[model samples]
Target: MQSVVEQFKQTYGRLNARSLGLLAELYTDDVLFQDPFRRLEGLGALTRYFAELYAHVETCSFTFEDEVVQSQQAVLLWTMSLRHPRLNGGQPVVVPGSTHVRFRHKIYFHRDYFDAGAMLYEHLPLIGMIVRFVKERV
Candidate 1:
C-alpha cells in the first residue's frame, strides 16, 4: 500500500499549466486555502480564487526542491518561477516555498506556506523597495 506521503506526491506532482482539475481532485470540497493575503474556504472558492490569482501571472511553474513526509502529513518544498506583471515582466523569483498537506479523501486539508517578500514584492521595483525598507526597520 502506498503511504500517505507517496499519495500526496502523486496527487500534487502532476500539476501543470492546465492542472486545475487535478488540483481540485486533490483538494476536498471544503479545502481551506490560507495565505497572507487571502483566506478561502471550499473547493469552489479555491478554484475561483486561483483563477484570479493566476491571472496576474502570465506563465508560472514549480519545481520541488525537497519533500518531508510522515504518516498522514507531508511537506513539499518547492522552487517556483513566474511571469509577473510588475517584476521585470516575468523575472524568475527563486525562493523557498513549502506546502503542508494533510491527507483525507484523496485530497489535502491544508497546503500553504511561502515568503511573500522573497517570492513577490521583493522581486518588484517600488514595492520591493518599500518592503525592504519596512523589513530593515522592523
Candidate 2:
C-alpha cells in the first residue's frame, strides 16, 4: 500500500500521453475521478477523458509537494504546469491544487480541488480582466 502511493506520486508527476497507458496499474476498473470542470467514472471513461484533454495540449506536468497517507486514503498537494493551444496562447499555466484519493489494491476514487478561475476564467482576455478584478476585491 505504501509502495502504491509512492508509485502514484512518481507516475503522476511524470504524466503525459505516453504514460497514460499506465493508468490501469494505478487505478481500478471502476475508478472515479473528478476535478473542477469534469467528473469521470470507470477507467475507460477516465482514459477517454484524458485522451481528449491532452489532444490539444502542448505540454503538461505535475510537481507533488506533499502527501499524507493513512489506511486506504491519501491526500496529495501538487502544482500543475500546463500549456495548451486554446489557453493563454499556448503558454505555460501553473495552477496549485490538491488531490484526495482512496484506494484498495488500486485507486478507486480521486478528487482534485483547485481554483477554476486561475486555471480557466482568469486566462481569458476580457473575462480574465473582470475575473481578476473581482478576485482582487474579494
Candidate No. with top lDDT: 2
In candidate 2, where is summed lDDT lowest over 10 consecutive residues?
10-19
Q: Candidate 2 lDDT, tens digit per residue, 14-95?
A: 7777678888989999999999989999999998888887777778888899999999899999999999876787798999
Q: Could you estimate the TM-score for every candidate? A: 0.79, 0.90
Q: What is the C-alpha RMSD of each candidate to the true structure, in Å?
A: 2.7, 1.7
lDDT of 1 at 81: 72
Candidate lDDT (C-alpha), each: 0.72, 0.88
Q: Candidate 2 at residue 52, lDDT? A: 81
